[model samples]
Target: MGFIKKLGYGLLAIVAAVALFVLLCAMNPNLTKGLSEILYGKDGNSGLIGSNTSEEVSAGSPGLSTPAEIGLPAADSGIDASSLVPYMPYNGTITTIPENVLGRNGYTPVTGTGEVLSEAQAKETEESIDKGSDGSNLEFDPEIYPYYAMLDSTCQALYKQIYANACDLVSSFAPCKIVNTDQVQYTFEAVFADHPELFYVQTAYTEKYTSDKKVVEIDMAYYTIANDLENARNSFDSAATAIEEGARQFPDDYSKEKYVHDTLIQTVVYDASAPMDQSAYSALVNGRSVCAGYARAYQYVMQKLGIPTYYCAGTSGEDHAWNIVKLGDGYYNVDVTWDDTDPSSYDYFNKTDGDYAGTHVRKSLSVYLPACNGTQYRNLESSAPVSDLEDESSSPSQPVSDAEPNHYDPYFDPYINNDPQKPLDYESEHPESSPTATNTSGNSNTTASPSNAAAQLAVYGLKESDAVTTLQDYYNDCKVQLVSCGMGDHCFYNIVPESLFKTIESEYGKQNYLGGYMNSALKTIGASNCNIVIQAERLGGGYYRIWHNVYVW
Candidate 1:
């Protein structure tokens, strides 16, 4: 019995020792690390499980064991780790109102019922309810109201606000469209409401007119659109005759003007042809055109008629060209081009007297006619008598010297001065001898000298060539000077008498030697008559270059 008790005691002591050993192993860092390696199937040398091991082992290495390797629940084996985790709602709260509550509030569901309100409830609503005497709560039936009326008043207000804002933005960016003559005139008329002060009136008999007389005098000078229309009545009659006569009398001049005029007249019908240019005339001998061609043809004809007329270029929707004629004290705007249109419609030939005196007005004379100062001609309206402006003076008014041809008049031809070659007094000098003299500018008594003429021609010819070559050389030299002057890749050459460059460009194509290079070079040297040496250097990784130069005349 004693031995049996001893054995039982020994067994109990062994069990207690095992529990103590398990606790010591759990607490021991090294022992616990080794146990983890055994359980996880990690290599003993790996630092991952065995803390004392120095060998590095990555968590995903083949030698390391994860939960799946130890016969534990695997990721895809119908085992959900999330099922073991705490539950959380995706969204904490609901936001939508209940349908029951909406219905309770007397709001019918759109999909459920076509009825908006109960008949009794609608009847109870007042026809004209005033919230605070400001006429705010005016109720109307939704079904009976217009579709647009059904829109919320707030929405209508917002739409108007947006439209106004958009319009303001557009007007700010493109003021030209808003403040144009058409718009301004319309607005002015609306504000004035036919007020007498707004419109100009002639002086009353009781009042002695000061500026009014000047205005009348100016108006008298102006050739009215009516006058032009009357003149046009005769145009068709004389047109064929004039063309044939012009071709016969002045073939070269006649063909040039005729070609241009005929083309304009033909093209005036098409509105799409508005804002045309001289090229339009050259394009079709008789094709559709606009005001530009009309103005050009008018000027051309007037020039042939010995009238001093200038072509004016200005802004009018597109680039528009008109005419300015030298009248007595100042230049007057005579848009024969505009006048040619119909009085009733926008037809090119029907612009009436009322239209000219009313719509399609012009301002800023300098913008188009550079020669006519804007300040001087701005108020000086067109006043040339229609007949006088169109008429050609007959007879030899003055002897033609070296002076430029007096404004040529198409209506009449002036006599050419006598040729100096056949002297008028030659018959008296040698009564029996036949007169023999040429209209030459050389000394009369001396025999013509070929050497002298040849020498003169040679010098003049060489001077011309030298001028061009000098300009070319200046451009080349200036290119170098531009470098040190802080101007890079930019330089120019300016030659005296600007026309010389034009002559060169005309004779030699603009793309010839020194053309492209000279274009860039010239901008640097500017418009000075001097030889320049320029140097250029690249700037900011772009094609731009800074240039500097010195001028030598």
Candidate 2:
């Protein structure tokens, strides 16, 4: 009986010890986890319920529906990371709409990047934006024409396709959907029909997707371009350096431009079948290329000199290319290729929009670049008429004063004395060209009633403060003459002296206030990049109507 009693007590003691151990582990999970790790190493305990580890918790939580239920985007939902957009810090909270948004620094992008554009005062930007009334078909969009016009036709098509495919790259870093092979192939062909200028893309193909546009597990393939950008960039650098060496032969943009114009005509011949003639490389390197090469080379050199210039392409009867040059007080279309015929002629050089009219048919994709109206540099020391020039005999016998009743500003001296090769006639040497002239300057358009430019910014998703800042900035920078400041469903209409367009660039240099105005407008609207679409109209002698959708891009 004593032996049996001892055995029973021992068994009871063992049971109590076991129960205590179990209670300790239950109270403190760390105890069990530590024990498990000691006994079985890492991965010893599978996900125990209610663990705070996201990796473990993410798999499943007792009654949890999905990641979405936990305020997280669902797994396998394309986006994999926290953010997919480029780093653009939000300026502030969005509140009531602003009065004026664009704080004009005078520099607005023609359409794309690296194109010598107008910088928003704070140095913001405009890229590719479609100002189409009908959003369905982007190709037919008229507002984007100026952007397209700035590039060679092939690049115009390329930029359009890439712009239309903005969704393909931005799934929050998710795997891109496999696109239709046909569409991908078409884009590739269109983009490289003659090799793109800005895209820098090499080989492109569809990755993973099944047939049937619908119900197919997909990845977007359009903007997922494989860039073969290195070699071409190297080539452009070399070309620019080489051109700059030669450009040093002349002083200012005007002189350098004329020298380049004449040199290109003297050096490069117009060839119908020049090899690889669509690039600046062919024109600058090989000294043999077609119109495209000439135009590209011209733009490259001009931009280096701090002069605003563009490679403009269009159908001059058939496929052709040329340049847009800002010289003296105006923008003109210069066809180095056309001017390079036997003996070479200046007839096609420095022509206005009206001058190039009926001759240059702008590509549909080009941005609506302002018309080339100022005839100052027309024909460059030759037969082209300086339309504003009065007959030498009609000049006032003596000098004019600020109080004079002349139709033009007395502050602006017309550079009346003439020297044949000097188009501006030493205007830089005179007092009229002083930066102070900007303050005294007045345009007839300013006499019109001024409207509140801020009211129109609401369409661009701006608060009243931002709107006021933008318009006030632009008004201060551009000194625009208000024709109207009315709002539409998604745009604004305003008027300024057309003369402002021509002089703003020259007066303020590249540091003009319009650049700030544009950047502010972009921030107000929350666009990731800058591409403000503005439509310009010739309001007759030195007046313009600008129809703009300020935040489309």
Candidate 3:
């Protein structure tokens, strides 16, 4: 009887120990995840009900939803679809909306880890928020601040809050108002995109929300600790100031912009593992960074010099970031990271949308950025401008009249400009000696019209109208125009019939047909790659004007 009682007592003790362990796991959320890791391996299926581990708590605990529930936007939401940038997770995967939530209006979920706060926890977190003034005095220019301009008034206010907090390096704060995960995410992104000076803060943030899912607390992450922030800022300012001062010495706007571009390429080396890889500080101070660092560095210096430069994030085979600078009146794309190749290249310097068609595509809120169409300053360093190639006054035979812009004179042979070897004055100096043109005598060396005019005739081949009727003809017309214009860096303009306008535009989206046609022309010039950008506009009478800026290498 004594032995039996002893064994029973031991078993009872064992059972109590098991129950205590279970109770502790239920209370501590992290304990459950730790158990999951032990059972399923460190990287195993930690998710039982939802994807976000922070939201995944034991049964009956008040927890946030996984994949974070985003309600449809209200009818009065006024959220532009373009303004909704995708949330990029720290692991580098893009967080997508659930299939069920597609087409519904709502905010996008910001990518980060945080918990749904209890009422008491919310009160505690709220107290920690610094109500101090730091970035309150900062002003934003709507024209220059593309991301800020995308936000509605409410979100704009949130942007100011996030910006101010980040500038001050406030560890945690309550949002100025009750905002969903979507507004917080977008506003946070806008703040970073618009302001490159917020280098210490990281993109991922932690949010504590009420059980009802209203975000109550935000903890902004930082790359630099508070003690080291001032030193980092001083270093950043020194480097940026030096670059800005150097750029100001240049005589023209293009020269100053180019100087900054060249300086960045020379200073920064592409290092994916560099500390603070996303911040301009990494590129400017450490001399090592990835695409984000390069872009932000360019943006900061240009903005300091009072050049309107915006950071552009997108995908180029992988995630990438670049800049769009307002040189003169038009915006032009400049990828300092890409141009910093071995021996350096101007492949992406001062390019247009058509110039970057397939290679670089803007994603998220960046799509709303102005289309880079400025051609005046493109490739200025690599080659002489067409105006510099020959004397414009030398072309007396084919005089350009301001009133008759499109007036074609077959006898004058305007295509003579296509040949770089032949001087424009050659025709006037030695009229009969010119190979590309004919003298006033009706006897002509060339039987066809000029490049552009002849291509126009081919598109309207035997048709009573001037529009391209089929996709095949449209493709052929573009290639012929490029080839006829000597396959050099030039713009090839074509008009599509109203019926085929949308279809031709669709081909550009497909990306295949344009490449095939551009490549065919490229082969003639003995170049393997080319920068070809096609921009189109709708004309009255069902006609569409399409133009291609083709630069071959």
Candidate 4:
């Protein structure tokens, strides 16, 4: 367990403590017997997690360099020597795909046009998303064209209908005319591929009416896939609930992105050996996964937040996956997989096309996605012009008052030690040594003032970076409570006493209107991120109460 997991001090802190069990179960035939035949078939892991200066990186280095003039023969165009690194799987074995043999695969070029456009310019060129279904540039079987190709509204609609059915997974009962069979099955695969939520399925086979080829029948094997899919659903519920709550306080693309980004890398580990590492099930429930799982998990969480994010695939040494996210004014690349490493980095967080030039390249279905050109979100925290985000001055719960206000600190860190830079109370929660250090990239801020990290760390026993993140959140807005006395599972408990507020709820008879008052108190102390939360509660006659004033880190 890491420092963050012990206190559960994060966006659903890295929840992989029980991963060993997951790995064991995945290898048991009774559990994963036919699962290997899913999407990737059987991946023989011949390599291990790639070594890097960072805590965990399986491919290229963190810094992006200008792509050299190195050009492979036309046949080798898609290969980026960097993609040669070996990756880890759920089984702890390393998988290494030979280099220089990938790219331009087979595919139908997007239509609505003629010429070409580089990925950076994908949006500027409308044709980028319009595919022609040439079939030559395709990767998946032509019958499964929808797997990696774009689809029209009519085709997409048909695809969804079949996907809506709960099938054997491989044999979803699908029927269509012989002439339309390919289109129907391709659409079905597309629907499944697009919905990473279908964590247990990868490939599909149809049982068509031999008497009538026009009518295709699919009887997917559902039993084998149901349990894993069920587990996946449960994970989604927990993750979605937590992320939605966070998004409510900080509504905006940047805030949502950070919240999701912080939550994922904080909880999941980049383990290629992880069974189902290629699926969201591995990351969310199993707790450890490779890049693909991490990317899908990030995509799922961001999508739930009302953000438009696409699962962009490309090669970064081996067959790799990442994301194309829309932020502020434009789209940018975000590789949660690579950033899963240490010293918390923003290198691939929100990057322009130029950043990926030589080291990265998009392939298959991902090629149709919008190009990433925005650079504003590159340094998410520092780049955010707070003036434009939601106002943090007033609490959504508390009303304004004219009388003197009693501003107090909410002390939530149950563990505090004498050491300034150490994590407090960890002796009881996670007593083991060599815990992971993931709270590295604290909120970025530019000011003439130095941070009060040392003091905050001493009082809370959190890492210096953790203090900074809390400070950033606290400084941005005081109305919202950032910390609370939370249990190991992230269940926080802290109440407000009604005597402290003039408006316990708002005029419409709302609740917790004390947000405005809380911000006022934080403003008094030049509030940064605070760890203790004490919120206002509605009492009779428009009175607001709190257990005590929340202590700031």
lDDT leader: 3
Give candidate 3's whole-model lDDT: 0.63
Candidate 3: where is the Cα deviation over 4 Å? 1-110, 127-137, 383-553
Ten residues in sequence with the least summed lDDT for candidate 1: 214-223
TM-score attained by model 2: 0.34
- Candidate 2 lDDT over 46-158, as tens digits, reads 43432244343232334322333212222222221332111111111122221221110111112211122233311221122222221134453322223333343333443
TM-score of each: 0.19, 0.34, 0.52, 0.42
Summarize candidate 4's per-residue lDDT along 1-553 as a digit string, tens digits: 7985757765334446346557876678655534433422333122133222434332223342112211111222222223232221122212343232232111111111112334434333332222222222213332222233355434544454445553333333333222244454445545544566666654344443332223334444432436676665676667656755665565346655766775676677676577766567677777788777877777777766767677665565456678778775578888776665544444567787666665466654454456677744454232111111133322122211111123422221122121111111211132222111111234321121223333323333433333212223432333433333211112122222222222221211211222333334444546432223233322222122232333342
lDDT against the true structure, per candidate, is 0.29, 0.42, 0.63, 0.43
True-structure RMSD, every candidate: 33.4, 24.4, 17.7, 25.8
Tell me the TM-score of model 1: 0.19
Give, for candidate 4, the lowest lDDT window spanning 10 residues: 104-113
Please give the lDDT score for candidate 1.
0.29
Error of 2 at 488 (Å): 47
List, residue by residue over 1-553, the lDDT tens digit for candidate 3: 9999999999999999999999998899899877787666454434443334543222222332112221223333334544443322122232343332122111122256679888998887788765444454567897778788877777777788888877776787777766777677777777778888888888788888887777887778888444598887898899999989877765556666877877787778887678878888889999998888888999999899888999887666556788899976488998887777665656678898777765666655666577787755565443221121134345232211111223232322332121121133312233444322332233553333344334434443422255677888888887788777663467666766645765654444333352447557756756544554444432323344565656656
